[model samples]
Target: MTPDNFIQNQKQQSSTPYPYPYPPPFSGPQPVHFSQYTPPVADSSILSHIMHSISSIDSRLSKLESMDKKLDKFDGLCEAVDSLFTRVKTSESDVKKTHYSISNIKLDELNAEKDNLWIAQASGGSGSPGKGSKLKKEIAEIHKQNSELKSTVSDLNLVIRPSLAHGCAVWLPSSASSQQIL
Candidate 1:
């Protein structure tokens, strides 16, 4: 016979009630031979086989449920990370506003410094007004703290970058849109 005909004959003989990736549908009462006369399959053997199949199906279903639960937990964690990023951004904005207002106050103090020279001289050549000096120190401290916070937030982005990349992969098989991360 030609190869095509032989292959077609093989296909016809291999009967299955379900599509690929699914188990073939179970047929009832398969005959088993133990002697020349061909005795029927023992009841105990049939019961054991059925039990084994049922156990396998149950385990697979249980594993599927466990995976679903883990995905839910991962989703919740991603939301929490997104919220934390939002809070950090809000705090950064607040700090920026405070820094701007403080800078304005320092500018006013600088303008007033020329006028305060007489007071400084009156106090035995101290050369600096007490209140102006105090304001300068405060402004310097604020600038230092703001710079530190900015650097910290920038560092946090470094850590978040790789985590977000991996998390997107776990949540979506296809490439996710850019808006999803933000």
Candidate 2:
């Protein structure tokens, strides 16, 4: 047979119009053979598997949502803790300031008291004017009185010694005798 006729014969013997083993490349819209086309049948096991996968995905999504809520609560708690920490720091600073102020006040008071005490000691007896001199005058008067009492006692002893040596009753004033007896 001739080559062209042999090629034509080969085309007629094949099912497709194209002489190549693969389908033809892109062309205009072709008529679809719906009569020979079959819709896919639903498989119970495969459908169940897909449903289970979707349910698992939904469950995972729900868990993630719950975790997100928990994270939000945790973030709020963190903020509260941070605020509390700041307040604590503020309180600590205030306390330190108060302590320093109190200590300074106490020191100032102590220094004033020390100065007052030194002044009081320098002037004697509560820093009153002439109070120390008055006490000194009183003490001197007491000493003078004590010396006079001693002289009088020595005179009495002189009078009593002779009478006791004679072993006789000495003439004495009643007051002197009473003083001697005492």
Which candidate achieves the best lDDT against the true structure? Answer: 2
| Alpha-carbon runs more than 4 Å astray in model 2 | 1-38, 127-182
Off by over 4 Å in 1: 1-46, 118-182
Q: How far is 26's C-alpha from truth in model 1 (Å)?
A: 29
lDDT of 1 by residue, 63-110 (tens): 999999999999999999999999999999999999999999999898
lDDT of 2 by residue, 99-129 (tens): 9999999999999988886677555666656
Highest TM-score model number: 2
> Global lDDT of each model?
0.73, 0.80
Rate residue 37 of model 2 by lDDT.
55
Indicate the residue-level lDDT of 130 in model 2.
72
Give the range where candidate 1 is weakest over 10 consecutive residues by summed lDDT.
Answer: 169-178
